[model samples]
Target chain A: MKCGYSYDELTAYFDGELPREEQSKLRQHLGCCGECASALEELRFVRSAVLSAWQAEIQAPEDLRSNVLGRLREEGAFRESLPVKTPVATGKGWKGFKGWGAAAAASALLVAGASWAWLAGNVDNAPLNTALIENKPAITEHIPPDKEVKEVTEKEPDGTAGGSATDNQPGDKPGIKNQGTAVTSPEKPGTPRQTDNAPQQTATGAIALKDYTGKAFLSVDKKSYSGYFQLTDNWRNYDSLDQKIKLTAAGYNAALAGSFKDSGGVVTINVPTASYNALYEDLKGLLSAGGIVKGSDTTVESIESQYKVVQTELEKVREEYEASAGDMEKQNQLANRQNSLIDQMEDLEQRARISTIAIKL
Target chain B: MGDLKTDVLIERCRQGSEAAFSELIQIYQNRVYTICFQLTGNSEDAKDLAQETFIRLYGALPGFRGQSAFTTWLYRIIHNLWANELRKRKNKQTISLNAPIHTEEGEIDRTPADEKSNPEQLIEAGEERKLIWTAIDTLNQEQRTVLVLRELHGYSYEEIARGLGWSPGTVKSRLNRARLHLKEQLLKLGVKPDKESQKDADIRKKVKQL
Candidate 1:
């Protein structure tokens, strides 16, 4: 067996899904190999950090059980009767069940109506930060006032009832505590607090954050900087744009990293993650100056799993050698397997850290 | 149910016992709500989803042949519902991370109101925690779902695969993507944690301070 294993096996090993023999060998390789060890460490850290972050836990509303039970009662989804046959209510949060429910619903609808009126031009400027249930503090990035949302909001008819992007009540900036001249308020009223808050330390021992983007994306897939992007832009001003990006990088303390140019107006460069945003904008402006921009995507998961496969294969070889301790051929086979898998893992790890960009003229 | 009682409750629920069903809800409410809220990111929708999950479980309980653990089955239902709702909301373009999670204390911001109690170190920790969550919530649904199931719910790879109706390989890959995405978000947050392991409480306390 080759020392290399498939990425799936390595992932499974991390999840404790591998058989004992396979696990033992992978452990052996992991102990000997820095790349695999690092991969494992990263895997664990991401998982732990993410899950711990998930600790911004929220409990279901106290009335949830009743609401569901009432709905079931109304719909007759269950035949079993409850021990306590509490009165059923149709309104949300029991507020609606009372006669006041109508008034509350009307008020809510009114607010929704007014919000749509205000939201057309505003509602996402303050970086909406809502406290979660059970004291879990969660801050949502302000959704930038991009065209898609603006267009969508514009196309919708008036008094369309739904929650606005800024779910907080108007003028209630619940999360932000100003220590300086922070940009918390919208340029005008009725904007949702959805700006990306970047905090800076002030000279007066206070922390202030500025809201940058009008709104941020809701998912990683939609996020501007989330993927390994293959960006393509019309190189109409390829020369000047290239120079502009260099300047932009310098301005942002970002590196252009590396670039390859050809006569066909094709240029490829490694943009440091920090400076990629600025360069990307510059690319967009050049394209707008009369060109097109396109990008392809690659996921890091693919590379990590591939490394795991190599790690797993290597482990199998070590197991084979361990089972046949004194066999010279087997000992030699184990050594060969270890060498092969170690190299494979390092390659995958390197690929995981680097993002590739290919630009054409 | 603590241990053996869980099995008994399952039996009762399977037999159409409302008491047992209510018991199940009481016991697992936190777990169920946690998953639901994490997926939906809205307290209102989460409540509705949680109720719907239990109601569905009530109907599906009789078919529960004990092939898998009850929690797994319940979570499967939750995952299916949450995913479907996400797709529907996405299709309608109505989904927004903008919705504030409602709590008993009215709508509170994800950022704590007062961090004056927290010292500087604690504040840094809180900021890191917040950064992590913001990243996690921003994760694409597929990857986010796999991550919540594995990392937070402690589901085995095979179990998650079975629950999601995907191959175990798919589960691992999604988790990888989710983790890397998380790492990137954290990197952007300027939180370069030393390669040492930190306890969840420390993270939580720090976050609370924020």
Candidate 2:
């Protein structure tokens, strides 16, 4: 069938902007119409060429941040504005879920710097930084499984713990949750803490490959969420890395299990530790520089020992919580610690069973 | 930045927090610079435009009523600033798209290039990239702005219209013309999608479907 669709429609369709009914009709037409398909293919060539030319991960000059901030400082612009009570302060379900919120905030802050490094092409020991931050592989859109986690937090009578109340800043959506396990209180205005996620030392050699294993936490229904390594290599980006991971996983006779719920670019696959190195080497070729650090070196014995340490911490927090009289603040802090410890144990237990490599392209 | 986090930063900025403002700059500096660079096609101009955009953003924060996505608002500021710069240079050339070419069947907005005109030589991926940038360099201000907003930033037609303060029809037609013109220019430069890119495109399409 010959399609008479105009070039405008074709461009819109190629960009995935066509409306649903028109999109479906166009899709059917392209399936049967060689002329339209070839036209669409040509458009892809143009996009690819343009992207290749202009999209090679250009970083703002190192001093741009300092320069912008310096300019603002000179004008006293930052000093003139004050925090206003915004209408979007809808964090009811998130008030007491300090563990997830803090971890997410911490990881977000950490990844903000790490991704700048990734684009700047100067990530020194990126894998070690990744391990420390627990930043997911997908630099953008790495929100953890929130529906189940939020439900857990909602059951508690005291969900509004920590400094969230004092923070008083609005604009928190209850629905979207940030993913990561690191913790930090949300920074207040005027505080010098967490001012800059300074770019790491420049990467001079190939990216060291590390085991991109993630910490899995199964909810009450057996669904698991983990922190995946974000694929930030600008040239290959997400699509190329995704394809590479799939091919490597198949070659290793592994199950490309599934991705985390609600997160795009995160893929969870279970490759045997024996065949992991071959798979790792295959994937390493995809990286431009900065090798992945071997993050998942936890043995059965090491996990066992770590599990014991977390258990002891949990016990200590539990004792403190029980011993506390009527101080809500102290009790709240203890409760948060207890919850964090329990989550750690669950993470350890899951790691003991099988290693899950989540590639967030 | 996550929407919530960005909101927090905006709030802090309003609260006269220099640290919060600095963090905001850190998060968005690269992106803002990329937009500026794409429009100006040079690092120096891009740096100046980006710095100017933030300075304007800081001044305009009290008026940002959260009516639009922060990015949408920010990009709108960029477009306005760039348009103003082009006016100052007095070189803002709007491609004359009003003329239609008469074909045997009917009038078309643009003539389809003869497929046989494309060079058959297989371009190395690196070489292809250099040629692509050269082709991009040939685009005028309007075409380059539309292409950058659509392809690099992935803004939709409606969003582009709203950001650029044009009607949806204008954005759609301009973006389409920009794409076709870029393709035509690429072929003119003897650049075609090499085998590697073709394979990657196929793989990307399948992944998108999955």
Candidate 3:
């Protein structure tokens, strides 16, 4: 019942937290004591102002409720979109079919000999046989008898000494024998020389195989299906066998053109094969070693299969070259065409290298 | 009016009636929003907190035991949620409650209207409010809670003590300190102390009693 209270007691009294007896006493004191009473009054006024200010209503924007509802709906939809128990498959699985088709195409090229192979697969198949036959006669007619004679001797490395009768004591016209030999040479070219220097001589003629001993330059013109291969040696005056080997190294599969003396020991082989398979293999190996295989599979089989397909296509081009006119112009054209195909094949090989399989690598 | 019929409406909402929930919102939205606005000191936050309170109420309706008044339970939830939010923000090193409040759509609109009031009057009123709010903000978390319940929400001291799990004496002491702080703030705001003001307040109380 004190008239003069502490600041703490005054605060308690203002908040109505004083005990009943204390509250009555404080009220009685406030009725008489002006200072305590006024202090309590000012506190009440402050409380009122604070309460009113704090209780001031806030008007929410018109769009808030709708926006919240919309967000909730969107959240629901997003949750629903997540993949549940079932797995979803997209496009049809045509990968297997495409792979089979590629293999089949490669096989078909191999079945057809070089002459008809390129033309049959890529160009008109109908006129390919006729073109082959026409080029066949010209190749037979233009090839020198000496060149054939050298081939015959080269084929028989063991028969090189005693095969003089087949060459000199020829009673039958050499032309007829040459024609028969020419037709049969492709079927079985006597002993297929493993080494280009090994001489291959047929019964009708001596065709010495030249060795690619020196630096052999293999040039692939992908725009043209022809690759130019040349062998340069130190000796200028070489034998027919050396010349033939150099030409073969150039990828020349044609009947031998007579060996001509050039200034240097440079033996140029204008092999009219559509592409250089051995060079392709070397390049393919280099690419694979450099880690360039397309798709995910960089396996040996994948690289080899890709190279084989390219080789088959190149052989087809070579056949087309032989089946066409055997003139230098036709040969050059075929070489150019084959070079282009080879370029495309190389690009595809590169694509295959850097594809999904390469990613794994 | 008729015991506010809130319990009946809440029961209807529990029975999966959307209309009943909407009616409930209409009935208590203002009070809930006022409570949030008072706590947050911004309309946008108030609306957000209020809406959240109702949404939580709806979700927890099945579990509501109805041991207490619906509004009291809801106020408790809102207070707890706001306290948690404040604590979270504090932990994040962002304690500026007076930073311009943004609407849910990220628009700022908190400047009080001037209307016909003179600049001096407006500023005085604004400063007084700011001072009191700042003092409230300075209270210990529990003191602030007890003060808000007793003074702002007008809950009885016993109710506040029960709600906050504090003894009545603790609640009284905390409220006393809070009010003293508020009075000192008002004195700094230049509100003149007058004994006649207490008699006026007593007369208003007596008339209400009559």
Candidate 4:
């Protein structure tokens, strides 16, 4: 459009967009070059046309303001902040905001009760040989001379071995499939012999124990197995039931750990041997009230020597701490290490002493 | 500087004043509607986009710290939303509503002809306006956007560059090219020859002033 400059430059010049020197040059070019001047005129004319055509105001739809506000309302912006006062909230049903209030109140009352006898038989984390050594004096009275403790076998309500919700993990063998009938039925004959569990430690190395004649088999298992029960609720009222059972387990000196599954209605937990015997009746009655006890079955698992190794390591660390003779940092490390080993041993022993009861809803 | 009234309204809206937000929407609704309508060229689509802009603004208003004029922030929203909508159907066959709808694969006027008994009323519009709109449709999104912002909405070159996230040089060049391209299209339409003589006295007066 110009002598050497392009139309874009001419357009820029028309709009007063060029630098001062470029503007002066373009102004001089326009005064001399008719072609460049005409090109700038064309740019102005067309741009003015576009301006006129597009500048006319298009009226907005009348309801647009209300519609925007209405959409925000529809998105629940207004309702989200308000406490949802539905019938469930008002009635204090077990699943709503009001229900939570009621639950909190109930839990407060229960905590105030503090009924668990945790000190009477704090046996879950008793020292490794405490039971074998302390209870050995009583073992000869009831246990057979040759019979060793067998691992507890777990059975679901449907009479399936290890098929209960508690036994879902592989190789998690539990005791006594038909032991419900055996325990409930007092006349079931029994001959005391060593359990065919194929002891991991030989008879020489295993805890030398005078096996209690059938008296030690108070649980759903044949052996005086570890006191872990994986109790699950088949009933719909599992949350409260779970909380209640946990409180009951703690009240009676039991270590309970398991979440209540929503769908399958399963809860796995541990109750110490003493606590199990104490709460078994009350637990059965509580669950039976909810109609979940019928589907509940206990599976006791055999305790392995993992705890023994931890205890041995802990003892060695303690001896090292004593020999270090006030090497405070090394002693601190050894003390920390010793505490960690003791904790692991306690956790293992607790697991070993509890019965796993899986209740199927 | 931003509008003081709008700033006050924004402050109250951030403080959870619903009525203030509603006032803000009412104040700016026409500008938003016009921008969306000009871009979309359809009343129904424009209405939807205008309302949608306000709904988005309702959600975004709390975050507006007034870094720029509310109108600039508002325009950015319109531009982004319009660009996304254009990109969604950009690759598809564009609807030439005057053309037949049926084809092997192309954009069809889903708005059936029977819906509008007098569809030719659109053609009966000013030929210059029609030509201008057609030429605008031909531009890539950036050129058309910058051209519209500069020529129609009166945004400064710097403002458009900031809003579009382009350098000032890029905005200026694209706007120039858009005008040149529009001029070419206008020439091919043979509109200048027929009307230039009558309007020349007026356009020439405006041009000399420019």
Task: Pick the DockQ winner.
Answer: 2
- Give the range where candidate 3 chain A is weakest over 10 consecutive residues by summed lDDT: A111-120
- lDDT per residue (tens digit) for residues A241-340 in model 3: 1132323333333432222222122233322112222222222232322222111110111233455666788899899898886588889878876875
For residues A143-164, write the lDDT of model 4, one tens digit per residue. Answer: 1111121111121231211112
Residues A21-113 of candidate 1: C-alpha lDDT, one tens digit per residue: 989989999877777777777667776676565555456668777665554433222223353334456425321122223432333211100
DockQ of 3: 0.05
DockQ of each: 0.16, 0.19, 0.05, 0.14
For every candidate structure, what is the RMSD over all alpha carbons to the true structure, in angstroms? 26.5, 23.7, 37.7, 28.4
Give the runs in model 4 whose Cα sits over 4 Å from its true position.
Answer: A78-361, B1-5, B84-93, B97-131, B134-142, B156-158, B166-173, B193-210
True-structure Cα RMSD, model 1 = 26.5
RMSD of 3: 37.7
Residue B150 in model 1: lDDT:
76
| Residue A56 shift from truth in candidate 4, angstroms | 2.4
Give the alpha carbon lDDT tens digit for every residue of B1-210 in model 3.
Answer: 124487787766544344566567666676676667566645655666776666545544544555555655677767655654454333233345445443222333233232324423534634545534544544545555666666556666777665545677877777777666666654544444433433434433332221
RMSD of 4: 28.4
DockQ-based CAPRI category assigned to the predicted complex of candidate 3: incorrect
lDDT of 4 by residue, B11-55 (tens): 766433447767888888877887876666556667767876776
lDDT (Cα, tens digit) per residue for candidate 2, span A1-361: 1567877778778878888999999999888888889998887777777665553445787767666654343222332222222211212111222343344333322111111111112234322122222332211111111232334334322221112111222222111112232122132223232111222233233223223233222111112222222222111111121233322311321323322222343343332222232333333332332223121211111144456777888888888898996989999888877866776675544333232233333
- Share of reference contacts kept by candidate 4: 0.36
Among these predicted structures, which one has the highest lDDT? 2
